[model samples]
Target: MIVSHPRRTIISRHEQFHLAQQALRRLDRGTGLIALGASLIVGAIAALIWLQPHLAPVPASIAINLMTIGIGAACLIAGWRRYSFHRQLRAATAITDAPMIDCWIENAFEGEPGVIAWELVTSQPDGTEVRLRQAQLIDPSLVTVFQRAATVPVRYVPANPTVSALIIE
Candidate 1:
């Protein structure tokens, strides 16, 4: 499908950064909860060790600490991945001139080319997909907004002319 957008609109880097930051924040909160749970488990184990002095506590405590640290490291890596992806997306300047659309074909299921349509997309309440009479595949950032509102801003590309996706303005 051909994607088209009005001439006046543009997606800003600041907006992309905002979306990425929000996603990172959510991830951080989840990681924090996990860390807290780990801490509680470690405390419980330590108490058990204290109650029975013959049972070695050092090794167990060290293991628990290692596990918690590993989890924290994984969360950090995930956050970094998200940040890098957004940074690259923000760096792409080609989509600025035209409306961007992402078209998912019926076949070629794994890697699909996004078709940008010039039309404005309506956002669904779930924020996972955009509704434009027909739903269009959108970036996670755009989905965040659509999950709240019924409509969203989109941009179309002139070169490819057929693909479009929602862009954060």
Candidate 2:
């Protein structure tokens, strides 16, 4: 069976970035909420410690508040970094034009269910060979297609053509 996807129209980098950011934001909403909740709780605890009577020493309370706040801040930073990494990847793909080529699968191995590592290779017009070897979780339905097809579509950045991936339709 042919594993196919609808053709995607060329999109501007800004628009692509916006869509990519929105998708990533949706995926990370849970983590973001968790981080926000943690931060709010820490803030509330600190506020209570400051405004209400506490048995702990002043210096100890201050230290505890600082530590909790720091942890909350770290969580938020981590969430932001994860979101930003996806945005950066999309931005790079948009900024650079990559040529789509027919790549043959040199080897394929299944890892976890629905995950595969594909070693793929393609040749450029000038006869330079490009290779890609990456493991990714893909739709199970496409496994047969990958096994049967002589070549699959891949795209590579000209600046670093050696690294490539199956074209994301």
Candidate 3:
């Protein structure tokens, strides 16, 4: 559908970065809750071990603990990676007083590891509607960038025709 509005000031790159950061923080908090749940389970297991050491073999208890630790560690690593990528994305663009639209298209990195791209249609008065482009054909690295970029806002500068900045909101 054709959507139009007023040309408002675009959000700055710094603001987009802040937004991305906030998103990551939310993710982190969710993960923290998961960790807390796992800890409680582990605590219960420990109690079980203490109450009935002979019920399960020592090796089995050790394995359970190992698995729990491994999963927790993996989650932490993944969260760190997400935060780092967003930080890099924050440097990709600046802010301006351009209008943009918010639109969605298919998953650009459907088959790829992490590649995604948005078709930046023309700017409008209120906001922009960016259609997702070629969801099935995306590179892994590009997907990583796009994933973070998508979370942040975007703005188009008229000075250079095909160039736009990812507002760090």
Against the reference, the lDDT scores of all candidates come to 0.40, 0.45, 0.40
Clashing pairs in 2: none
In model 3, the worst 10-residue window by lDDT is 1-10
Taking every candidate in turn, the Cα RMSD to the unseen true structure, in Å, is 14.6, 11.9, 14.5
Q: Which candidate is the best by TM-score?
A: 2
lDDT of 2 at 115: 27
Candidate 1: residue 111 lDDT (0-100): 32
Q: In order, how many clashes per candidate?
A: 33, 0, 22
Candidate 3 global TM-score: 0.32
Query: TM-score-based ranking, best first?
Result: 2, 3, 1
Question: Candidate 2, 126: how far from true, in Å?
Answer: 21
- Selected candidate, larger TM-score, 2 vs 3: 2
Off by over 4 Å in 1: 1-57, 96-165
TM-score of each: 0.31, 0.43, 0.32
